[model samples]
Every structure is written in structure tokens, then in C-alpha cells.
Target: MDEVSPEETPSQKVPPWLFRAILTGAVALGGLYVLGWLIAELKMLIVIVLVSFFLSFALEPAVNRMERLGIRRGVGTGIMFLALLAAVGLFLWAIGTVLADQIGDFADDAPGYINDIEDWLEDTFDIEVDAQGLLDEFQEGGAVANLATRLADNLINLGATVLQVLFQILTIALFTFYLVAEGPKLRRNICSLLPAERQRQVLSIWNLAIDKTGGYIYSRLILAVISFLVHWLVFWLVGAPFPVPMAMWVGLISQFVPVIGTYIAGALPVIIGLLDQPSTGLAMLIAIVVYQQVENYLLQPKVTAHTMEIHVTVAFGSVIVGSLLLGAVGAVLALPAAATIQAFLASYLERHEVVQELEDAEAAQHPEREPLGDRLRQMLDRVFTPK
Candidate 1:
């Protein structure tokens, strides 16, 4: 082969632009991968931030009202925080007390419940059950002792988890405090960087978000109160133990929690009822089902029509999608998020008035289409012919 100089080499013939393009592409892909890795690592932090932001939006209206009444934003936020903490503390206390008592009662009566269930099964399905013998075998096998040992061993892990949860709650509270107390400052700082028109647009969007979020909170609160009152009366009438806390449980969970919340809320009282008396459980179930129907048809529509302005199907879909993406947190945040997005889009989307009469007349006049060829010819003439 003939000798070739370095400049004449085939490799050297490659264009400079090709090398630069390859280098740039490699850098971009590497950066993207790094970004993805960081996001995965910081996923929990991202969820905390999102929750804080949602809470801030929900709290903004109250803070603003307090501000207008001449209270300092920080003070207002602190007051709100204290009130919220108090309410939560009360709720927890109620739940803890009732649950402790109820758990003890349930443990005591568990044998009776089992016996009843076995008898019912035997009577209804003609199946023989030797529950006492089975229980004796289970006791002899030391499964209960093993279970206790496992629970004791996991206590440390449970403590750590509780600490982790508290830390996350504190982090979210700090973020929410800053967001709400500095709401105006944050908006101003953001708007300062934009053009006048862009600033207006941003502010409008911010206001819209606040409205939707606050409206959602208020509407849910109203519904929760109504539900609490209704269920409290029913539970009281039915002689359920801890009616107040149980009603509160039903109210808050049914209103605030998404998807399976109602079932979880209703299941507790129904179980308690069933444990107490079958008739009580049946009544509880009937009341819950009837109330659900009334709320779906009457209360929910009237309350959410103005505030959420989102269709039921859309809300259901959003909840499903959110739950899939972020599990429980996403589901809780789905409604306000969907409402905000819907309102934002509605503002931007163009609309034209519908002419029902004209549409009906046109359809009546031309119920069937002409031949495809004739239609194509008309379209061609419309397009090709001069205006």
C-alpha cells in the first residue's frame, strides 16, 4: 500500500461538525441520565414539597383574610398552624382512646365472634367446623408466641418509621409556613423577573390556583361537617360506641380521602356494629349506602358545581391516574390539581356559541350525503376557485 500522511488519513477526513454533534449528543444524554437518577433518589423529598405546596395553596385564602384584617402574615400562619395542630391532636386522642378500648373489647370477644361465625357457617352451608380443636392445635404449634416475638422484634423498626414520619411532617410544615407567610413576597419576586404581560399572566394563574385550591378545601370542609352531623346522629341512634369519633372518622375520610376512603371509613363502624349486633351492622350499611346516593346526586353536585367545575368522570379518572403515579398522596391531591388544571385550560380555550336551531335545520335539510365524487368536486371547486 502507498504510504499516507496523517492529514490524508480516512479518520481525519471526518467533518468537524460530526464530531461536535456526537459530543453534544453524548453530553445531553449523560446529563439526562444523571437528572433521572437524581430525581429517583430525591423522590421522597419531591413528594414532601408537593404536599407542602398544596397545603400552602389551601391556606392562602385564610392568610390573606387575616392580612386584610391587619394581622401579620407570620402570626396568621402560626395561628392557623396551632389551630390545625389542636384539631389533629383532638382527632388522634379520640381515635387512640376509642381504638384502645375497642381493641381490648374485640380481643375479649374474639372467641365469641368466632363461635358465632362458625355456627352460622355450619347452619348456612352445612359445613362442619371444629374451631376449638383448630384453636388448640394453633396454640400447641406456638404460632401465636412466634407472632408476638416477631412483633416485638419489629418494634424498633416501627419506632424508626414513626420518627421518619414526624420528620417529614415537620419538613412539610416548615415549607408550608414559608410559602404561606411569604406568599406575596414570593409572587412579587417571581413576577419581577418577567415582562409586564407575562407578570399579569403569572399572577392570574397564581390567583386561579389559589381560588381552586381554597374553594376545594372549603367545599370539602362543608361536606365533611354535614356528613359528620348526619353520621353522628345515626351512630348515636344506633347506640354505637364512640359515636363522635366514629362519625368524625367517617366524615373526614369520606370527604378528604380518595377512592377507597369511603370503604375504609365505613368498614370500621360496620365492623363495630357487627360485633355489637347484626341488626346494627345492617342498619349502618343501609344508612351509609343511602347517604352516599343522596350526596352523589344532591349534595356533591350543588356544592362542587361552582367550585370544582369538573365533571364526575373527569374527577374519577384524575384520581385513578394520580393514585397510579404517586399512590396515596397523589390520590389526595388529585381533585384540587384537576380542578386547577381544568380552570386554567377553560380560561385559555376558545369557545363559540352553539346554534341549535340552525344545526337542526341543516341536518333536516341534508340528512344524507351526496356521492363522494360530487362532494370531492365541490370541495375542489371551493379550494381551487377564486374567493
Candidate 2:
């Protein structure tokens, strides 16, 4: 074979446009990555938008029902908004009352709790304990003063956070109202952009996502109630202090959190029980474990399956990955995200050529025949009159 000349070399002959395209793609990808990072950094805004979207979907049925009852769309939306506000306010008030009572009880029993802790530590480790000495040392070193200062700072920060949260809620509510009012038009506008052939699939996927998200929210609310009741009953049976308050807190928090939620919720009861009586603490731990098992195997399956078909393994994995990426919020949002992703993938697969072929084959093999009446008439004619 003839040796290739320098000018004719394959690498040298590569088009300039190809190199330009590669460079342009690299820059575009880099910009997109940066943009994604910025969006992640603005997590609070993202959370508000997500909350608004989910709330709109969750409340749509109620709004529609109200409309069916001769209410105008605006009136229906307004009533839903007011109802939501009232519910939130009532929940907050209840939580506040319980927390106040628990705090007072804690204060009244502080000395006893401290003494019990000291006794347990001394006995368990076979060492002398000096609570007074530690306190004196802490005060002398100005640690207590520093702690007070830090607490004050934290309180101020917390107040600011509360204000910010209120603002976000107001924004979300306003946005949710608009979303509910204009959702139909918005949906139509979105579908109008897609090709006619693809619109049905796209709309189906959208419906699947909304239904799944709404179902998940409803199931979680139910689960929270069940968890609260079960925990409260168990705590009362075991004579755990502040059972109602603790159970409510545990239920609400665990519902918001994912994989590690049960453990966190179990911690408070166990600690309080241990402080009161060690044996009760052990019993409380066993109760928590058993209840979680039941919830996972029985309650969760029945409730969540109706909305989104996801495996427990997938849920757990999503939570783990989410936690690694964005802490508690990620873990809380993980299941919905996973379900949405799965819906998209499933819709895509259902539209694929292989899936269509398989379905067609199955249809051909089990072709639907005519009605029994038609078959009977044909059989009678063949038997009585046909030659």
C-alpha cells in the first residue's frame, strides 16, 4: 500500500467545523452545570415552588367539588385557601400548647433528671461523678455566659427564619391560587406545544406524576396520624411521660423525614424513659422497632401502592442518595422525585417499538371474538338451514 502523504493524513484532514462543534458543546455543558449548581444553591426558592405545585394538585379536587356545588372558580379557590390557612394555624397552635406543657414539666423535673443521669453514669462506669464541680468549672471558665450569648444569637436568627418562612408561605399560597385557577389553561398550553401524536403520552405522564404526588401526600398525612395515635397509645400504656406531646412530635417529624426518621423519633421517648426508668426505656425501644416493622410491611404498602408503584428498596435507595446530595430536605423529597423519574421512564418504555410489538403479538394471539348472540345465530343457521 502507498504511504499516506502528510497533507492526506486522517487526523490532519478532520474538518474545522467538527472541532468548533466539540468546543461549543463543551462550553454549553459547562454553563449548564454551573446553572444547575446555582439552582441548587437557591434551594429555599425551589422548595417553595415545589410546595406550591404539590399543594395545588392536592387541593384541586376540593376546588373542583366546590365549583360543582355552584361556586365560581375564584370563590372555590378562595375557600380552599382559607381552609388551608385555618388548618395550618390550628396545627401550629396545638403543637405550641403541647410543647409549652412539655417544657414546663421538663423544668420542674430537671433536678431529678440530672440526679438520675449522674447516678446511672456513676454506677455503669464505676466512677465518681461531680455535677456541681462541672457546673462551677463551666461558670468559672465563662462557658455558661458564652452559651447564653450563643443562645441569644440563635434566637435572633430563629426569629428571622420564622419571618422568612412566613413570607415564603404567603408567596407559595399566592402562587398556588394562580396555579389552581389557571392550571387547565396552563396544561392546554403545554400540550399544544407538543406534536399531536406525542400529546396524549405527555398528558398521561403529567397526570401520572400529579396523581402520584398527590397520593403520596395524602398517604403520608394518614401515616402521620396513624403513627401519632399508635405511639401515643403505646406511650400511655407504658406510662411514659408527655406521651401525647412526644407522640405528636414524633409522628409529624417522622412523616417529613425518610429513612432515618423513625430512629430520630424513637430517640426522644427512649431518652425520657431512660431518665424516668431504664426498663421502660428498653420497652419503648422494642415498641418503636415493632411499630416501624408493621408500618413498613403493612401500612405503607397498602397506602402508597395506590398512588405510585415503587418498591421499598427503591424508596430506601432514593432517600439515601437524596440525603447524600442535599441533607434532610433531599431525603424528604426523594420519594416523589423517584416516582416522577420512574413515571417518565415507564411512559417512554411503553411507547418503545419493542413494547408495541410485544403488545401487538399478545393481542393477535388472544384476538377478541364477536358477541355470544352473533355466534349462536350463525351456529343455528348452519345447523338448521345451511347446506
- Estimate, for each residue in 98-160, the C-alpha lDDT of model 1 and write its tens digit: 889988998998999899999999999998899999989998999989988999889988999
Stretch of 10 with least lDDT, candidate 1: 371-380
What clash pairs does model 2 have?
none
Clashes of each: 0, 0
Flag regions of model 2 displaced more than 4 Å: 1-19, 26-30, 33-43, 82-91, 111-147, 351-387
RMSD of 1: 11.5
The per-prediction CA RMSD against the true structure, in angstroms, equals 11.5, 11.9
C-alpha lDDT values of all predictions: 0.89, 0.81
Please estimate how well model 1 matches the true structure, expressed as its whole-model Cα lDDT.
0.89
